[model samples]
Target chain A: MSGLAETFAAAAQEQRGVLIGYLPAGYPTHETCVSALTAMVRSGVDVVEVGLPYSDPLMDGPTIQRAVDASLAGGTRIADVLRTVESVAATGAATLVMSYWNPIEQYGARRFAADLAAAGGVGVITPDLTPEEGGEWLAATAEHGLDPVFLVAPSSTDARIAQIAGIGRGFIYAASTMGVTGTRDRVSGSAPQLVARVRTVTKTPVAVGLGVGSAAQAAEVAGYADGVIVGSAFVRRLLDSAGAEPETGVRAVAELAAELAGGVRQRRPRPV
Target chain B: MDPLPDPSGHFGRYGGRFVPEALIAALDELERAYQQARGEPGFTAVLDRLLASYVGRPTPLSDAPRLSEHAGGARLLLKREDLAHTGSHKLNNALGQALLAQSMGKTRIIAETGAGQHGVATATACAALGLECRVYMGEVDTARQALNVARMRMLGAEVVPVGTGSRTLKDAINEAMRDWVTNVADTHYVIGSVMGPHPFPMMVRDFQRVIGVEARRQVLERVGRLPDAVVACVGGGSNAIGMFHPFLPDEGVRLVGYEAAGEGVDTGRHAATMSGGRPGVLHGMRSYLLQDEDGQTVETHSISAGLDYPGVGPEHAWLRDTGRVSYRPVTDDEAMRAMALTSRTEGIIPAIETAHALHGALVLGRELGPEAVIAVSFSGRGDKDMDTAARYFELLDGPP
Candidate 1:
């Protein structure tokens, strides 16, 4: 079996908490993307998610959209994104791509899956690709040893949660709200309950995303699920430091990840 | 061969497929079906019967003598497309495409609309034909054109409001294209106008040709000859093409297309692509487009709901370039005034889109003189546009 999912699962088990980190590829510049991902892993991020920029991303809030626009303006393509992943994987950090469906369709699904897998991408998390429509993609992605992650929203029913979890191999993404992804002052009201409900279904690890901005929210979600994913907050940090030196943005994300990792490490159970 | 739109489907240099490899197969299929449907006797018979009985075709060519006298004594003939069933020429193309979809063994029809006119038309035809119908509109449009949204729902069509960028017509088109790409197996995309990738432009034109075909026969029977000038508004240019196609070979007939000048072309706030825009690619066709330097579509403004688009049909570009038809702009104030002028004088409330054509006839008639016979297409009725017109004219208050 591939060590990707096991690596994540083992980290969650050992830390008695979830590992979460984010990377907006081609942020500042594509030339520094690989180094950023490497810095994220070296700073103790368990799993890394590289965001693929889309022209029109309905699910993203302002902060992420601005980051995506900057990345696109810098000429980031799926090829460049996967190449960055390959370079980062050489340093041994498991990588997953989070993107909308348009670019994947534009690149041809089978070819995208094949190339990403070859570049050491472990999985893909497309917020918009529903399971009923993802059967062909599921087969294609599975063929290349790349797990296709699925998202279950608070609005999703128990049956839907199970259905998504069944098709999902990597961690199942649990959306914190009914609205698009954004930073929030607090974790969603139904997020913990939704994660708990998903636990009753397939044994797939659940990771709550969308609106979890601070280390406190990440630590809180670590108490419930396998992991917590932060995107908009990290993207905002990068945008703020855009005019500054290149390493500033990378160091910012790494600092946030280290802080969140510290919180998870403090609460984690001792391994048998 | 049609002398107006060449066999390659160029109005001059306007309409041709400028799409990726993924859509090429579908475009080719549509072109083949359209070409076959053109020469098929059964196809014409079915379309003709639908236009006659269902859509109430052979709409009167009423000589608007009162309105004519008001327009400097110029003779004006109204091609009553508004009198067609469902109160618009949209039904003509919708009914034809619905029939084609049924014949093609497709069980579902998908369409995208801006003001919901095309959605209502497609819904009505789908209800008539017992086919599943889905109409996508921008969320903003659904809110503004609520009555038409209700009309589509009442006709048993599923109305999906696209909530993407700007929440308007262009976004709705993008969403509809995505849906089509996903559901191409059993769904037939009934494009609303003579835009989009090839085959759609050609197919919609063929479906709408009845407008020109009937107007020609009606003009010959009524006036004993073709009109000296034919005028219609151009958005996606469907209604204009319907009225201009058959007369393309008629050397004596002069064709004029009216574009919407929202404020004024010089203010850079108009939908007058043919009048003020440059050649570019948009919505899968190369045409006269209102686009920025980066080829991003700019917002188009027009008082007329249907004519508010940043780009025009490819065929219209060809027609403008080849000098086969002259394109001019009618400002918002001009269209609104013409709407009231036609409504009060002729007791016919014309759609704002068609009012642009009437505004053109008012100007062209004086230039052509008293003996000039002019036919202007009344594309749709104004009932669907009462809210827009009432607000524009401030008719919310009691009589002025």
Candidate 2:
């Protein structure tokens, strides 16, 4: 079974909420990234997403882009990122490699998936890889026991949602906004509506991402999603704590994650 | 023969595949396809037919005698790119890519535009090919160039307003690149200029080189030898390179690149990267870029949206470094004045982006004298700039 499916299954049975934390692999430095992931896992992060930096990170917000740029400038490579994942996975926390499709295509999808699985990565969240073009990677990922997650935006049609959910193995990444990933003043109005729409299609766990930057936003999204993915906010905290104590950044994210996880756990079942 | 721009795609230290690992295979595939297509007679014939019939190529080399007389009687030949279908040289590259896209079995076309010229051109090609088209444009540009936006929509393109950072050309490009990354399977990104990573810069340049190829042949056929100088405006520097590449080996034929000096270079408002900027990497390649201390791209302003860019193409950088081309700045006021002069004398209203080259031609003409033949690439028509021109000249106050 895919590690992502196993993890989600385990979380669903235990009624334990999932906290997905994203960190650019080489931010500050590659050596620092290992410690960062370890700290995130130690601080109650259920799943750690190691971002593979790209030069043109179009879907990212300013904070994530800054982290990507910093990681890229620090000379981070795919090999280094995988190594970081291996080190983080040694701690027993699930690891997910989050990157754009270009980097994966450059690395040869099958080889990359096999290497990622060998490195102990549980899954991948390639936000830019559409389901229509995901056959090779999906097959490779399935072989490696690494789940290939797909994103469904609020604007995604019912047919697209069904297709994505049908093909997706780990969990459905629900983008909260119509545009790129970032922190916003409010969660998209259609996000909850879309989640309800997606629920009608498949039983797959849907993780809401993008604009879930604060505890309030995360909690709000967690009310509807099976998992909550916080990217830009955590990346921003890392940027703020750069050259300072890295644990401070990890702790801040941990507190935010713990708060949101509490909200998901406390959700009352709808009257049947 | 040129040895620098090898099959691997390095243009004299300017162009190469600087993309991340995930896209290497796609780039390699594209490179192979482009190589195969370049050598195929059928492919070339089809492209040629489209260029000739669809884009109305071999755009006239009009001798602007009246404008020449105004420039102190200096000989000025305008490579009339304005007469091309879609009213710009942008169509030439778009049509070539559209053909390639069709051959690749891609049914959707996506493009990024600053002033909407490339978007319109791409939309036109997509319409001709019966392909789905999406164009990303900065919100600011969409507002400034609304008529072009409507024109693109009329050509069956869905215009997506990019409301990202600065809401301009750079943001539009970022969004377009994002779309390409997500939709790489059935979509081909028809990049506008000689920029971007690896194959895009090289491919776009090859498509645009037709401009210089025809211009060079026409100049030679008309004057018996190469003109003394070739000049064109540089934004991402595609048009400049299109006019300069064929004449690179001709030592006597000086190439001049004119850049937009928004207010003035010292005022920190100009888009003249070669004149006032330093070498830095942006949008995939290292080139002369306008950037902050933190390496962030800086905001640029020009009277012409098409010319307002923070970086010049890598080839232009190499040319500048090699001293093969002289890069100079023309102020917004100067370009406007030149536009007026050209319209009045030659009855051809040039886009403000192209007027930079016109301004440069007038300056160089006086210095080189009337006997010196000069070819200036008139990159696009001024119709799209009519709104800005009306505001600039206060035509709204009186005209019905």
Candidate 3:
């Protein structure tokens, strides 16, 4: 099994949800990004998604958008992103690239797949490329032995979920809400129902993303979802601590990841 | 060749719903509604009535006899889209989308504008239909086209100034998409052009097809046959695509689209997507776009704010790929010269965006000879361009 699959299987055996952490590549700086992810994985994160920053991040809210913008402004290139992934993957966390489709399409799908795999990255989660348009990318990823994860939304129909399951290689990413990525006051009431719907279509592990921020929220999702994916909250910590010491920001991000991981471990599925 | 976009909403390999998962259901809903509306006669009747009475249809096809003199003996006929109710061709699409929004039981309309022409048009349509209206404009554009901002506000629309990433048309679109994602239940994003994802490119083209439909019949009536060539400016490419669609079946008519070359195509500072770009996805569809090696959208410069965009419509990209239409770049200086020449010769001023079409038509006319008839999409009146034109011509300095 792939490292990503193994990690999810291990967590499932323990009756705990897998904890996934996200950070944009080259955020703050390339070296700092690797350090932060290493710290995150050492403490808790089972999967680390290193974001390849694009200029127009349509799916991201203000928090991730600001970090992406700053990364772009700092001259963070695709090479930098790959380097960050290599460093993070060395820490034994299954690493993936979360990006809009254009960068991969522009970088040449086959070339991107080969480069990413060579850099020790496990897979990619393309937020924009649906099953309908993912044929070429899927072929390329398969050729390079890289997992291709896809997102299924709360608004997705049953037929669409089935189609996504047929094409997606890694665990399916379920957007918890019908909106861009951000920390909300409450997780959408539809998230657990959406996960249930995905299970009806495929036995693949279902990970809930988009609104899992705090430990309590992660625990709430852990009750139903196979994995808890948090992004904007980690970015918010880094952003909020930008003025303080760099070590302070890194520690805060790691500590939050650990706390969320604890929530996933403590909250066992209620006799399901 | 295959009835525009296929069932999957693809224009060749260009157009698709390359958006976030959150927007998928909304796009699906929009596609279903648009398909239903396309079939219903009542919808067409309502749109037709609104087009004829509310937005002013069948705008005249005027012959620019004096302007033809400079076209090296070729005759120039202007499809007077500039004379529409809102002084531009933007009203045609705005009103159609507004009516569609109403049919969907949506009460709020949101749109993004470049030079504010689309904003004013959308605002006017919303006011006419009693719908809530919001227009997103780039911070730079709100300053460059302040008058149009005032025009939109006067028409009872709120203007949102987006201050992000170059602060131009592209950023404005990003903000608008964000708003739509946040308020997808109650709000309808009445996309301003034939760009955006799926249904929008196809839907906006259908709404604006009135331009080519009328122009084709008028030209045949006036010249006793189809014009030898048709020219229009390409921004997000709505106007150009609208003027070219009906003429596609006529094998003899040549379709040409002019993109704004801010300085020159070689200067690396132009909005000429066709002249300098590669195929990539941005703002929901796969199209020809001006982007860097990392697929980041590049900043485009053009004197005409309307033409300062880095991407063209997906259909335009497909058309260019198939050799059905040709796209060329017109420099700022050349477009300005055409604007001045048209004003002096025909006693009619054209918007800077429209002047690019005029410039393209002049070039085509010179090549096609004296017996040739070239139809140009004079897309908007020049009233909005008085300040820029005056400054460029040094008329603002009082007869230099």
Candidate 4:
């Protein structure tokens, strides 16, 4: 099994869902990002998604988009992202890169896959790359012994789910509800159904993301999902703590990760 | 040439769906609705009638004898899409998309605009069709093209200024895509240009191709032959593709597209995508894009808000690669000069976007010499660009 699958298996053995955290590679500065990500892992995040900031982030809300914009402004190139992955993976958590497709394509699919694998990264979750346009990416990942993750939206048909699950090597990223990446007042009505439908097709673990803001929401998602992913909420914390001491930002992220980690552990069984 | 964009919407690997899975269902639905609409007499009849009665179609190809004489003596004919409803060619695609949305039972329409021309056109179409309309425009564009922003509001559409990523056309597109992803169930995204994912490029091209079709017929009847060259300005390349597609089979006629070179092609700020960029994926299509070594889309500048974009239409990229057409850059100064020249010589004020093509006609005219008959796609009028023109000519002080 891939490291991502093994991470999910380990979480399943704990009778709880995995806690996933996301942070742009070079928000504010690269050193601060590494310290914060390391803090997240130490605080019990089972998987780390180091964001590769792109100029156009269509799926992100204002908070994440602003953070990404600052990251790009700070000159966080592809190498910095890889260096980030290498640092975070040293903590022994499953590490993945979440990026738009253009950067990877520009980096040469084969080269990017090979470099990512060498950096100890386990997978990639590309939001913009559909299966139709994923030929070269799929080949590169397969050759590099790395898993590729694809997102399944609430609007995705059953056939699309099946097709995505069939080729997806790691856990399927289930975007909770609709809309871009942001915090919402409530969990989506469609999350449980999307997970259940995904269950009928592939046994690969399902991780729910998008709009998961707090520990309570995390708990709610963990009740049905194998992984509870939080992005904008974590980004909101870091963004708010942007100018404070580096330790303050790290502490803020650590506190939230610990809270969310507790949320996953306290979730009731899947009600099976 | 052999009816491009095969069943899957791949124009030789340049066009396809590169969007997130969340928007795929909407794209599929649109493709289905459009496929049905094009085949049914009920749909085509309504669209055609609207084009004739409302949009003032078959806009005349005006003869510009003085302008021709100024361009080294080539006979010049301008396809006056500027005469269309909403003062631009944008209404052609907007009406078609609004109609398609109505057919699909969608009541809300969303769009992204650069110069607010598309925003106004979409607003006008929605008002005519009795649907809710919202437009996203870049903050910078909103400030520069405030006239169009007001026009869209007067036409009953809500204008949302997007404040992100250079605050330009690409940012507006990003914001609109976000809104569409959220409201896909009840809304239709009317992409203003022949860019983006499948179905949009094909559909917008089909809607705007009426320009070339009418121009070709008009040119044949008046001049007794096809023009030696056809020129159009390209941003996301809707008007250019519309003007070039019908003439693809006319092997002897040259197809030329001019891109906005803000200062100069070498200046990093210019939006000369095909002239200065390489093939990459952006805005849901694989096309020639202005991006950095790390693949981040670079900020682009142009005097004309409409042509300030980082990517071009995928079909234009394919055509450039296959040598079926040629793309060059026209600097901001060149377009401004052409805008003035056209107004003075032809007594017509052309949009800065269309002025790029007019400048291309000047250069191509000089190259091909006296007997050459050159056709230009005058895509929009300069009414909305008066502010920019005024600022450019220093007429801001009430013209002295």
Best by DockQ: 4
Among incorrect, acceptable, medium and high, the docking class of model 2 is incorrect
Query: Which residue ranges in model 3 land beyond 4 Å of their true spot?
Result: A268-272, B397-400
Clashes of each: 8, 8, 0, 0
User: DockQ for model 1?
Assistant: 0.04
The alpha-carbon lDDT assigned to residue A99 of candidate 1 equals: 71
Worst 10 residues of 1 chain B by lDDT: B17-26
Per-residue accuracy of model 2 over B19-40 as CA lDDT, tens digit each: 3322444566677888899999
Among all candidates shown, the one with the greatest TM-score: 4
TM-score of chain A of each: 0.93, 0.91, 0.97, 0.97
In candidate 3, position A107 carries an lDDT of: 93
iRMSD per prediction, in order: 11.4, 9.8, 1.1, 0.5
Candidates 1 and 2 compared: the better one by DockQ is: 2
Question: All predictions: root-mean-square deviation over Cα?
Answer: 11.4, 10.6, 2.0, 1.5
Deviating ranges (above 4 Å) for candidate 4 = A269-272, B396-400
How displaced is residue A179 in candidate 3, in Å?
A: 1.0
If you superpose only chain B onto the true chain B, what TM-score does each candidate give? Answer: 0.95, 0.97, 0.98, 0.98
Q: Write the per-residue lDDT of candidate 3 for residues B1-400, one digit (tens) a residue.
A: 5697898888989998888776878888988998899899999998898888877788999999999989987999999988899899999999988888899999999999999899999999999999999999999999989899999999999999988888999999999998998788889999988998888999999989999999999999999999999999999999988999999999999999999999999999999998899999999999999999989999999999999999999999999999989999999999999999999999999999999999998888889999999999999999988878878987765545
Q: Which stretches of candidate 1 lie over 4 Å from their true place?
A: A1-272, B1-13, B397-400
